[model samples]
Target: MGLHQGPDPYDRQLCQGSLQRPGEDIHPPRPRGSGDRLRHPRRERGSVTLAVVRVRGIINVKNDIRDTLTMLGLGRVNHCVLIDETPQYMGMVRKVRDYVTYGPIDAETAALLLKERGRLEGRKPLDESIIKEMGEFKSFDDMGKAIAEGQLNWS
Candidate 1:
């Protein structure tokens, strides 16, 4: 139907939570006590995250699932994405969990990952000392510590 043709009935129903896609799960977010608790503790206190890594190839996967993986920055295997354990990101991870492995990321691991994978413009590897000299932080360890502690602005 055209946009000027009033709202589509199907669209209305979906927005009102009146329609359910067959075989789709749309329940409220599960309590923070169930599976993956250790790896995805509540982020209400401070910075912590769920580390999602694509573990399998996507051959023969559905288009939507593939898209979800891409959205999470895990379009390829061995790629990892650190997402805060918020409802929104958690929901995305749930969608493509079958093709990925996820767990809580600790501070030490976060620091190490930042050193190994975090890059600057032109694909130049980012070193903590460089950032420290520029005054973004006092030292590489401080930056890494902040990141590991989920104290940096991820946005």
Candidate 2:
């Protein structure tokens, strides 16, 4: 008969402590017969080379994830970057996981990626002649092996 409802059912539940209150820790109790302890496995950090490839586009992507992709040097689709397995790099990769795919890469795969997709100044494709001209390594394979083994320092 009145325009205003006397009390809301949701507010009633909150008054009964069904919702979390400010500055208080509220965790639901586990059901009967449930396991008593929380199980968590520890992971060890190992030295490994990770190759991340951008598989998705930037359409409708959030600014934070876009910045992460930019910092990783992946500005376009199908672009890839080789990074060491570290927490900092892993965190950035995780932030953009939906737009990229990453995994451990072997020496042979690294060489192949360099041969097929590597670029240089003026957008020139990487080739054996350039490697010979630069005299950085014997060939792409050697460079790839060094990169995978963490022997090559970019900086």
Clashes of 2: 0
Tens-digit lDDT track of model 2 for 1-155? 68897776667678887685457786788766623254222223435678899999999999999999999999999988888877799899999999999987789998888888778878899899988988779898998887776666331
What is candidate 2's local distance difference test score?
0.80
Clashing pairs in 1: 39-104
Candidate 1 structure quality by residue, lDDT tens digits, 35-153:
55544444553356667899999989999999999888886899988777667787888999899999877767777787788777788887866787767677556676676566774
| Clash count, one per candidate | 1, 0
Candidate 1 versus truth, CA RMSD in Å, comes to 14.5
Q: Write down the lDDT of every candidate, Cα atoms only.
A: 0.75, 0.80
The 10-residue segment of model 1 with minimum total lDDT is 38-47
Candidate 1 TM-score versus the reference: 0.65
